[model samples]
Target: MIRSYRLLSLLVLALFALEPLQAQLMNKGTIKFEVTDVQTNNPDMQQMIGSMKGMAQTLQFDGAQQQMTVDMMGGLMRINTFWTGANSTVETYMDMMGQKIKTIMSNEDVEKMRKESEAMIKSEDIKYDKSVTKKILGKDCYKAYYETDANGQKFSMEMYVTEDIKVPNSFLQNLNQIELKGTPLMWIMDAGMMKMTFMATDISKDLGSDFFKKPEGAYQEMSMEQLKQMGMGGQIGF
Candidate 1:
């Protein structure tokens, strides 16, 4: 379960790691994606989770406001993260057992995490192959390939990038680490026996302002460490 959680987190990060280039070419729009397929190498996990399809995530970028929101939903897990250039806040809601729990990471917490991650950053080689071209969601894209080792585990990635649209490079370090270029319209990640693909289904310009705001209500807020403990304890329950 812990491994699965980590894989899912990586998947989300890969799907939204866009960096800014020229400001004039920046496109402000919302991209909706669906998890088209999922499979793992572990037979035990295969028996437990079966197929992971129909999971949905949305990425909204407002170039004028310099803000973005990512909302990912799968079964009983819902994660909403808001990014404002340099800082971010994450609100994760989980339905574990019969209890509904929520975890919030304020901007200060996210800044601390950023510092810690920077201190641990290491150099890794990434190779890109742009031999294939395809049209995804009406946009022309070229396929690029790369591989990396994260936390001693190796993973390979196939990404479809386009030169037509440019996005802000808020997470420039992450993009440089992965060695990705252009805009990624679709991404497929393979780690061990686990494989998942996220493809954009639609792009629209009118994402309402309310979509990025934090919800107003009661939720049992917890720290990042507590959330990790719950996640490891199988309290994710998804």
Candidate 2:
């Protein structure tokens, strides 16, 4: 009887461990969003457009936990973003002008970015306002208004989340068709007076540790102004 009880307990524990692993395997896939410039007037704005052809991205999620790693690039810009959870932490590394800059952020940075995006969407202060629900690309979304104090800039923004569509391989697939609900993985805003959209794409289940590795070439870091003078600052705009 003792041996039988011990075996039963072990089986239960194994099953418990397998549950999360199964969920992760089921959720493992790729997502992609296309980034495009819809508004173009200022030369600086035109130069910052993600891609007339649209940008592509890939992300991987670990089902056992609310963690994900994203790989994205547009033209000369590249970035790797990691998120532990919705309100936990986010880290990003941006490659610009042959140099990489890393940003380790807390929930505060995420909230700040959220507020700024909300302001751009509403052309007003979003701090005290509640977000409204809407539909984008056939997926339910939440939206809010926001405005910028810098140069008195104004923008319209929209955010979306979805969970319906599932793919087998997220790294190679395009995310334009995935049906998801209540996922805060998309952001649309105006940068330098240009309307731009960022879509999550090419999600993966197995992201190697090296996916976040820095480049191998030797690089000379430069300040924003110096990079601009060298015509390499545009890489930082996306």
Query: Which one wins on lDDT?
Result: 1
What does candidate 1's lDDT look like per residue over 79-197, in tens digits?
Answer: 45445555445455543322445665576765565555444342234344567888987777887676667688776777787776655443222342233456676877787777878
Write down the worst ten-residue block by lDDT for model 2. Answer: 14-23
Clashes of each: 5, 34
Alpha-carbon RMSD to native, per candidate: 5.1, 16.9
Candidate that scores best on TM-score: 1
Residue pairs that clash (backbone atoms under 3 angstroms), model 1: 19-168, 19-169, 20-168, 20-169, 41-193
Worst 10 residues of 1 by lDDT: 170-179
Query: What local distance difference test score does each model get?
Result: 0.55, 0.39
TM-score, structure 2 vs. true: 0.46
